[model samples]
Target chain A: MEDPKSLSNEESLRIITQMIQTAKGNLKGSSFYFLLWGWVGTLGNLGHFLLIQFSDIEYPSAIWLITVPAWIISLLYGYRQSAKEKVRTYSDTLIAWLWMGFSVCAVILIFSGRFNELIPATILMIAGLATFMTGLILKYKPLVYGGSSFWIFSAMALHVEPVYGLLISAVAIVVGYLIPGYILRSTI
Target chain B: MIPDFKDLDPLLHSQLRLAIMSLLISVQSAEFVFIKEKTGATAGNLSVQIDKLMNAEYIEVTKSFKGKKPVTTCKITKKGIKAFEDYVNTLQGYIKK
Candidate 1:
């Protein structure tokens, strides 16, 4: 290998740029996680709403049981991808921790079983912050916009009926997760 | 145009070492295998350079067992971060000139 001193100024700059690009490429796999959650949440929200509207089921919230399988799949998928990831960047660690914190809060809220009509909005608000922070770190605009959409929809959800809140939740997922997820994928 | 080269740190002036530093700057810590794959350097060569950086106190290395196999992880020290930042600033100065 050539010593760094031997390289011209331009060559040095080139190496720095190349390495940064490579680091970013490593983050592309994260799109799968976003897409997975986005699609799953979308289905869950819509399914719950439809069931509540037309079905005579005693516990319409039971439709959310689908999240059990979704969570299992996400964990397995995340673990497999994690094992394959050789490099762990600073932003990567931060983003992971952010989501982990969100998950903890979410579980606690779900267990608390309070504010049934407000849960969806609360989740969206949290999701907005996470998505927005990620966008700022990565300097990706689409995600920032997506995150903003979540905040907007979350407010709208508060004004709507419980059944309608599900629809708002679904729209937020599509905007916040699915759009950016696909954009991140294409950049890879 | 000629770039000002006086401010460049000699320790970070080697191609392999520079690559290693660049990688370390972006992440909190990375495994030996990860650095090896990214830098495309052989284990012996990479180990030597890693040791050099460690001796300089620019990075810290930890050796632990993951299950039955040993894992070596490298992290940039505070000194390393300062050095990398200085090098980058110097580079930018040169580029600007």
Candidate 2:
């Protein structure tokens, strides 16, 4: 590292390539967020299904309240991650912004309160896009497939009754979110 | 033709400084400790090289407190990216010759 005056072009090229590779390879996947959302989404869907089918609940949709705690947990996890993450790679920044955009869009759709029947499809489509781009950036195939699975489920969800759609949504979270989330967690 | 070492950017010609620029260019930003670990440079040496880059406007260095602990982060500036690209193109010219 001292006085590389005698260093050859090949040596400089080697150093640049080696260091760039090191930086690119240093980023680990944020699997916790994915898994957390995956479980929460799955439960939210299944809870609605169970509450509606098994018990004569006054409001089955109220089961979606589970996301309240999930949001707090996600925030705490992100705070802890930012505290320890030494390198903020472009991929990380891009992914963070992508999800933030997704969240904003999702919130806008829900608050519009017009597409109540289309809510499940809308969520799946946005989730699919985010997951797909994330996989593309990270070059991870399982997540790429996971993202595609959401679209497939989205199509199926559209054709079913809202009650049946809940079950389909649960299965989608399992295949499209939870499975890939676990794979990402294990790989890291 | 033999390679013209004189044509190379002297700032980026050295081993450690070039390595630092190379690493910084690849990421959005990196912590001082992370750069040190990656470059395998000592803290004192790393600080000196970082200062040189900062003074040259080749990189931006920021210092802030993370709770009670101090943190330093480095990011390659636009000039740094341009210089690095030009250096690579120049090196490639020598190789192609």
Each model's backbone clash number: 3, 0
Q: Tens-digit lDDT track for model 2 on A152-187?
A: 998899898877888998999999889988888887
Q: What is the C-alpha local distance difference test score of each model?
A: 0.84, 0.88
Candidate 1 stretches with Cα past 4 Å from truth are: A1-17, B1-8, B64-70, B86-97
Model 2 / residue A114 / CA error / Å: 0.9
How far out, in Å, is residue A122 in model 1? 2.0
lDDT of 2 by residue, B1-97 (tens): 4555538898898888999999999999999999999999999889988998899999999998888999999999999999999999989988998
Q: Model 2 interface RMSD, in angstroms?
A: 2.0
Residue A178 in candidate 1, Cα distance off native in Å: 2.4
Across B1-96, the per-residue lDDT of candidate 1 in tens digits comes to: 355455688778777888888888878788999899888988888998999899999999999776587889999999998988898888888788
Residue-by-residue lDDT tens digits, candidate 1, A100-183: 998888887777888777888898889899889888877888888998899999999999897899999999999999988998
